[model samples]
Target: MTETVKEYLRIDGTEDDKLLGFLIDSAKEYLTGAGVKGTDSKRYELAVIMLVTHWYENREAVGKVLGKVQLGLQSIILQLKAEGLKSE
Candidate 1:
């Protein structure tokens, strides 16, 4: 049976929260590189879901490293978004 999309996406207000966001952005890039469409790639989705669960379970250790990475990524994304808004 096919696994349904996981609900952990709703997690908020922790270091893992930002890491999850970064993982999602990375997963989209990965899927695109593999020629997979977001709507049709169950395989990509499942892979991301599993990786997220692994991170969540190990957050005590992973969170410190991920938090630093996520902060940098979040800053970049915010800058891009600001530029886009200014351009429009």
Candidate 2:
């Protein structure tokens, strides 16, 4: 997944790559910890929803970061799907 993410970021040439990496790391850490207790699921969901809403509403720096990350993720998924199909 990290390799896929890096590949995606490499295409963008955006300076926010480091910040995006940090956010992805933090989200993974939080999700791991949350999964241990079996609580915090709603909190995590709410946090994501709020963050997305804030990005859409602002349409500024944060929104740009979000857009790039989304595009990267989409590319990664598409690549993975293609690879899976090739294997089959």
Best by lDDT: 1
lDDT (10s digit) by residue, model 1, range 37-75: 444334445544654555555666542225544454445
Distance from true location, Cα of 58 in model 1, Å: 8.8
Model 2's alpha-carbon lDDT is: 0.44
Error of 1 at 61 (Å): 14
lDDT of each: 0.48, 0.44
Residue 34's lDDT within candidate 1 is 39
* Worst 10-residue lDDT window, candidate 1: 1-10
Which residue pairs show collisions in model 1? Answer: none
Q: Give the TM-score comparing model 2 with the true structure, all chains together.
A: 0.31
**Can you give the TM-score per candidate against the true fold?**
0.39, 0.31
Model 1 ranges with Cα > 4 A deviation: 1-13, 40-44, 51-88
Candidate 1's error at 23, in angstroms? 0.6
Enumerate clash totals for all models, in the order shown: 0, 0
